[model samples]
Target: MQRRIIIAGGGTGGHIFPAIAIANALKKIDPETEILFVGARGKMEMEKVPQAGYKIEGLEIAGFNRSNMFKNLLLPFKLLKSLGQARRIINEFKPQAVVGVGGYASFPILRKAQGKGIPTLIQEQNSFAGKANMVLGKKAKKICTGYDGMEKFFPADKIVVTGNPVRGNITQSSVTREEAAQHFGLQRGKTTVFAVGGSLGAKAINEALHPLLASFVEKDIQLIWQTGKPYFETAKTAAAAYASHVKVFEFINLMDFAYKAADVVISRAGALAIAELCVVKKPVIFVPYPFAAEDHQTFNAQSLVNKKAAILIKNDDAAAQLGTTLFSLVQNKALMEQLEENIGKLGNTNADMVIAKQVMALIG
Candidate 1:
């Protein structure tokens, strides 16, 4: 029988990319498997999902505003409306199973699916589960996790450690170091550092690195920096004086090359980024985004730090500590190699395939 599945989530690349990876994996395993994405309207998934060649339906939904009480007045109405929309989508699509990837849209769709006795699976990317996932986990047929010890958050029997699914280009990249350096117009034999702050760019990282451009050139280091859109112009302007050693981009489209070129990386400790770094096996200095839900990014980074697989610099301390941290790690060959080896052990290149098979099992 032909299978149909709904993958729900979005808001950030961390959520959307994993969802897409799973969708692609499902198709690869069973070409006739039909997949539909459910995301919140105006979120990145609406555009990204379609671009990945899947049909998507968006609900008029928004997460509760924790910082401001006044803004949450209409949240009840929105939730009620989205629940109705989710029900309609479920009925119209008749999915064999629904997968929740942890975003505002996942709650309603998974809730409705569970209520109807349809199997639902959740992909919780963070070590510290989000509230939405915690609630939904109660009724989900299975909960796929990126980190271990998630049994504390979800039912132990329902939890499976699948690791986070990373984009194929990253996990399967064949880009050589020489090709990577040439792509960035950088010279070989110079230690390269790739600093990325997620898809939208991280302000703390950009600001911390801005004053250190000259130092990078002085040390003969090469930098491939993704400054995100907000800080791009200023970062580009600042990096112009040392153009030979520094490359500044608003967003990097070819991340595989960036990973190949780097001896060390500076990144926000988002789950997806960590997953990719592990797959690529690079020594990383993580600056956890402080405002993340439940401060889960910190938990994500600490998980690796505990395993001796990565380093952590708090967001508040990045300005003062990131530069020193980066320079020291890049120069420490033994530590870098150790980190690379330990982190590599944590990478699961087949997470998408594993999750897809799990979803298929629920259908059976």
Candidate 2:
């Protein structure tokens, strides 16, 4: 029989990348496997998934707005519409198994699949599970997770610790520091710091790093900044004066090279970000996004900090203290090495493969 699968989710890189990784792994195992992606309309996955060489269908869906009650008034209609769309997609696709990587679109597809008596899997990419996954857990046959001790969040029997899947290129990258520096047009000898706040950008990190650009230039430090879309223009204007030492981007297409070029990294402690950082084995200072559900970013970062694998800076203190703290990190060679070694120990490079195998097995 032909094996057909449906992978659903995506609003951010944290979800999209892992879904792609798992899809790629599934393909590698059986090149003839038919995989279809279901995502929310207007989400990044619509573009990103196809670019990664897979077919994706978008449903008319949007997540709840906690701050705006008016926006949520239309949510019930959207949810009903999306559930109808999901059922049609599942019926037409006739997938042997459905995998949900947590996102707004995931719930409807997984819920419908479970209702139809199809095998289902939910990949929870956070230390704390998202509400969508929590709700879907009752009917899901398996739950793949990036962290341990998640019995409180889901049925312990259903949980499988597969870790989060990072892009294959980054995990297997052979690009040297000098080669990566040349890729970014940065000088080889200078201390390079890569600061990122994920794909959408972090306002606090951009603001904190903006005032310190001149200080970095004065000290002959090299910088790679991913300012995200909203802050790009302003960040570009500030970086214009020191173009030689600074490279500012709205989004980084070549993350493999970016990870290779860094001596130190400052980033948000998103689950996917933490997984990639572990693979890159770089010294890191994480600023957990405080507004995240259950303050999960802090929990994600704390897991590493407890193990002395990374340093954590609170969001409130980030703008005031990040510059000075990063300066100290860059100067401490011993601490940098310690962090790199310890974090590297946590990297699970074969998570995509593990997830694919388990999903196949559970369905069989």
Candidate 3:
């Protein structure tokens, strides 16, 4: 009998990318394995998972809204509805195991799977567990984590320190810096900095980089900026005067190329982003999103800083210090090399495969 797996999650690329990586790993181990995805109705996973050539069913669910207490009034009803929907999906799919990568949508699916006595696996990308994952961890047969000390979150015996899974193109690309620069139509021999604010874009990061636009071009510094959808038009207009030295986009789907072209990186410290940077081996300035669940982004970056791996600038001070910090990195070869080598030591290139194999063994 062919084995079937259910991958559930994705409100951001951090969760979506790792989920896809795990799915690809499962298929590699057993080519005949059947895979399905479960996601929130309007989240990016609906499009992204299907694009990865997997079937994903949507649940009518939403996470708690800290911004509006009144908006959370319907939380109980939605949770109940999603639980019913997940039961139907799991029953129809008849999955051998369900793998959750940490999103609001994943909670109900994994919860119902546990109730049904189906094996459940979890991938906790963040060093700190989200509330939902914390609850889910109680029953997860195997919990794969990017960082150590996760036994504090899940069962000690069930934990696997497999690190976070990154994309194939990011880990195995043969594109050179020069080639990537040409692909982005950027000039050769200029110091290039890559700035990405994640899937929705960071308003503060965008504001910080916006003022440094002309200075970047003036100092022969090229920037590969992913402004994300919300701010692309505004950022594009802002950079029009120095358009030649900058490449601004709503998204960079070809991140492998972008990573190659970068001399230094300025990014929000998402877990998957940190994992990719470790593999790319670049000098990076991390601006941790202060509002992340449990402030996990800061914890993620702090782990690297503790090892003397990378530099961090607080989110509030990014506007004042981001440009200067990146400029210093570009000019200081020793500092750049030190960061690259130290952070690269933390890379786990085969985490997805290790995680998938563990999940399979648990079910078997």
Candidate 4:
């Protein structure tokens, strides 16, 4: 008999990508497995999930507003409505298992699924668990975590340290640096620094890089920048003066190539980004977003920094320090190589497969 499952999550690429990777893994393990995704309406996953070749159902839900209390007045109604919608979807799909990957829509869907006695699993991608996942952990049949010491969040017995699921294209990349540079129209003579601030772009990182564009050219450094949507035009304009040495885009769809071309990386320390960087085994300068829930991004970067596998720059200091830091690191081939070796040891190339086995075991 074909096994049917539903995976729920997504407000950001961090959640969406892992959810898709797990879904793909399940399919690979059992070609007859039927997978469906549940995400918040109008969120990135609504678009990205289908792009990954999966069926998705969107719920009308939103997270609590920490800034404006008035915006949260409707949260209760939205939650109830989303729960009802989730129940309807579950009834129609009749899934044997429901997995939650920690996003705005995850709580209601998993909560409803658990109430119905369906086997449930929640994948916690951060070193610190989010409030949504914390609440769902109690009822979850299994809790898969990306970092160690997760006993601080979920039950120790329930937790499985599966690491985070990185996109298969990245872990299995066979693209050579020369081929990647040629594809991106970059010359191979100089060190290449790749900067990405997640799927939406980080305003601070964009602003920091804007002034240093010409300096990178002057230093004979090549850059591949993913400026994200809001900063694309500005980044494009800034890179125009250094056309031969710099490339800028709102989003880089060809990330495998970008990873190959990067001798070093500048990025926000989102869990998914950290996972991909580890798998790529690149030296990274992480400017963790300060406002991440419980300041988890800093913890994520600190974990690697403690092992001397990556550099850490506080978000507040990035603008003033990033340029100098990049220049210094580019000149220090020894330190870069050291970071590469240590970080490569931390990579988990089979996280997707691990999660797949756990999901099947819990549901079976």
lDDT of 3 by residue, 1-364 (tens): 7998899888888999999999999999999999999999999999999999999999999988878899899999999999999999999999989999988889999999999999999899998889898898898888888999887778899888999999998899999888999989999988889999888889889989998998887888899999988899999999889888988999988899999998899888999999999998888899999999899999999999999899999999998998888887888899999999999999888998999899889768
Candidate 2 wrong stretches, greater than 4 Å: none
Tens digits of per-residue lDDT for model 4, 128-173? 8898899899999999999998898888999999999999888888
Residues 1-364 of candidate 2: C-alpha lDDT, one tens digit per residue = 6799999999989989999999999999888889999999999999999999999999999988777889999999999999999999999999999999988899999999999999999999888888878989988999999999899999999999989999988888888888999988999888999999999999989999999999898989999999999999999999999898889999998898998899999999999999999988989999999888778899999999999999999999988999999998888999999999999999999999999998788667
Q: Which pairs of residues clash in candidate 1, taking residues 3 or more apart in a chain or in different chains?
A: none
Model 4 / residue 313 / CA error / Å: 0.7
Task: Kindly list the per-residue Cα lDDT of model 1 for residues 1-364, writing each as its tens digit.
Answer: 9999999989999999999999999999899999999999999999999999999999999987878989899999999999999999999999999999998999999999999999999999999999989999999999999999988898999999999999999888889999999999999988999999999999999999999999999999999999999999999999999999999999998999999999999999999999999999999999999999999999999999999999999999999998888898888999999999999999999999999999999999
Estimated TM-score per prediction? 0.98, 0.97, 0.97, 0.97
| Model 2 lDDT at residue 311 | 96
Error of 3 at 131 (Å): 1.2
Best candidate according to lDDT: 1
List runs of model 1 lying over 4 Å from the truth: none
Identify the superior model by lDDT, candidate 1 or candidate 3.
1
lDDT score at residue 113, model 4, on the 0-100 scale: 90
Clashing residue pairs in candidate 2 (N, C-alpha, C atoms within 3 angstroms): none
Count clashing residue pairs in model 4.
0
Clashing pairs in 4: none
Question: In lDDT terms, how accurate is model 2?
Answer: 0.92
Candidate 2 vs 4: which has more lDDT: 2
